[model samples]
Target: MSGIIQLDNSDCSYIKANVSNSHNDAVAFEMKFAKDITIAQLKSKLEILTGGSASTMKVELYKGDTFVTALSNNDAKLGFYVNCDGLRLHVIDTFASFGFDSESVEKFELTNDQYEQRGDSVRNFLKQNRLGKYNDEEMQQMEAKRREHAEQMQKRAESCVLGARCQVTVAGNPTRRGTIMYNGPLEGKTGIFIGVQYDEPLGKNNGSVGGKSYFVCPPNYGGFVSPLSVEVGDFPPENFDLDDEL
Candidate 1:
């Protein structure tokens, strides 16, 4: 007669088992536990993973789809059971079925109107503190600053003449030499933008953005920048030689 061969406990130090629980049907994970650990110790470690109390957790062993036996003896070593690698350990959390799991608990939520009416809400705090939009003086100052920024950008855009050799100097980026191809407010945008054709493939687009063609250039050789970032000058193209030594 042929039967399943079981290995000695001393042969392997640990067994890799897939863990699942009835609380969360969608979740399953694999863990490796030492064969020398007691069933109670295994359950203690599993509490952190499954959120089930170790004392009340019932662990069942399975070989593929076949049910083996319940690990009812907590004091018995995990190796004392007929388990090995690739086995499944199904944890039955009895308390979880009664809505003990946080996911299963019903949550209370407030509508926008209800939240706005609460005195302890963030909106109320901001309003009471005269912060953000609630401060009329700050709003007026912000509007003035915005208008000043727009005027400065307009001057910069006027300075960037089309077909002029220019260099882009944006913070945190390498200086890029390019020819100014277009300089104006983009379609559906508020601020002015300067379109440039880089000397090399150091750009993000082919002279187009948001389905609108601002200018025409080769692929990966065109980009748009803020008008203030472009400076019209005698910036010449840098020669790139493949055979140059480092």
Candidate 2:
């Protein structure tokens, strides 16, 4: 019969663990576990901290040399593996080694416009997956900075020349290309509005916008847009056919 060996209170210590993905990106975590902690218990803690499954982790203990033993038995207590304070454990993610096509890991960069396209989804994901280490004040400050940047971008777009080619993305519609005919507040409007002469008749009215006439244009060829929805860039003028021009 095998006898169980009890560890004193002083024997419990914090283990310095590093979990590395296939790309060699590593996150450090301080794990406090007693000598009686099982391999499964340790991997579970690592899973929560690293945002990965414990089943895919390959655990290795650092005692002194590279020949140190690996922790492969889920039922074995940590005491049966090593005996050292400040012991280090390396957890390699086998799931992340399968390449980009696998659902294991995803990496990509987004431009400013690309980010705005899926901003709502990105915000929700960030809020849901944020680490507990970030304080409330820190999160608020981050949000404030993001709002400020967006306001600055809108201001820059509003500074575009009146005759410049532009594009505006309105809710419930795809991006519409046009020319900035006017930029300012209109009667009965409290904020600045951008008057656009669309390439196609994808607009609500002629140059007269918001129940007020700002410029002359064919019917259903002009519209007013919000400065925030506008993007100024080089776009070729639309060749108007004589039939449609009427």
Candidate 3:
């Protein structure tokens, strides 16, 4: 699926090139990789898709694709947004929209030894699996499982509510007030699963003095969420388009 971008204030005439229904002043999907992709080829990739030269274009960080920030105007990644959006990118220099998670980039700096060893291990694993080596039914099951696992990982990375204003005292009325949970169910309080853990899967709270476990949320500000909401990645039967009817 093309990545969903929500346009903010900038006029989007350039969208006509890479997107259909460009005249629609609403949310649209901008395909991220519909063209040939190569090693360290970010600029050509953008130019090819947006019909513009990446070097001369301005950039911005957009939520979905719009909702430009009021801060972070100097970042270079903004070019990515402009190139993908096919227009002069506007720089955002403020807090991201109230209801959106700020876009993030985490770069892992690995030692040369680590990189080489990891690459070799990956290569060996792929070679072991090879291609065209499984039966049709087995392939279907495997694909479904892979998709499920991916979905789980994505969900885990995203938390629906970053900070919930809750008051807890652990029966002793701790000195501080106002609460926000980073990773799990709080005692006597249910958590909204931005993602979930599995059956009896223990959770490590990001907060200090963490010692609480909730069963579920009851659909209220403080309701307990379902146990199934927090789950470890699992291999499940894939439901493709044909299976939608079921």
Candidate 4:
């Protein structure tokens, strides 16, 4: 409603398909479906230009003198909400948006190995194919595929995060260090940290005898990442060469 956020080419520092992970309030901020020129895109370009590890990232959006910090917190009120015009798009996601009157939607959480920063790959592909902007039809197609993939991954990854009687571990240990849960043997070193006691943040003074807690997942594996349902995973580069003209 805020005019599609009017996101432009130079206004972003980085827009990652990820969970905000910060619990300044009860809600987590997720940055996904990044298009346009955003902070992530800029960070990718800087990486390509400078050729180095992504440095300390401090991104902020500006309209005039004020900087936007997603949602505002009422330290006095003790709660937080997603920012207005806040957006997160996922092909494989935890939270599903069933508009109008769909109330059966269920969100799942899991922990896995950290994924690398691929926004540059995405940006490069977009630039190569001249697909920087998203039209309605394309956006719709992407959203649909995201949901589909999310469902499938949910089947695979959810086992390690949620279950009846479960044990979760990360990095080949039974210490339960991540958000993985399993109902059966993996036959390999994967899918741990399921059914662990992940923590949440409460008022500093609101801690019970148990204490406030949250998940300590590795980077890139914390936030939700989308899966592509385009099928035919073996498409050659030539098949996608004209993506710009799409």
Instruction: Return whichever of 1 and 2 wins on TM-score.
Output: 1
Among all windows of 10 consecutive residues in model 2, the one with the lowest summed lDDT is 1-10
Among all candidates shown, the one with the greatest TM-score: 1
Instruction: Estimate the TM-score of every prediction.
Output: 0.48, 0.37, 0.20, 0.23
- Write model 1 residue lDDT over 25-69, tens digit each, in one string: 334555679988999999998888787889899998765456667
Predictions in order: lDDT:
0.74, 0.61, 0.32, 0.28
RMSD, one per candidate, in order:
23.5, 25.4, 23.2, 22.9
Alpha carbon lDDT of residue 13, candidate 1?
Answer: 76
lDDT accuracy of residue 182 in candidate 4: 24
- Sequence-dependent TM-score of model 4: 0.23
lDDT score, residue 56, model 1? 90
Question: In candidate 4, what are the lDDT values of residues 1-246, reduced to their tens digit?
Answer: 110122222324334332221111122222332334444444444344333222433322322123323322112110111111233321111222335344565634322222123444443354445442323454565456546644664464443333232222221122212222222222211222122322222112121112322333332222111111011122222233565785
- Evaluation by TM-score, superior candidate among 3 and 4: 4
Error of 3 at 149 (Å): 19
On lDDT, the stronger of 3 and 4 is 3
| Candidate 4 backbone clash number | 24
Best by lDDT: 1
> lDDT (0-100) at residue 163 of candidate 2?
91
Q: Which residues of candidate 4, in runs, are more than 4 Å off?
A: 1-56, 59-130, 133-138, 149-163, 167-194, 197-246
Distance from true position, residue 22, model 1, in Å? 37
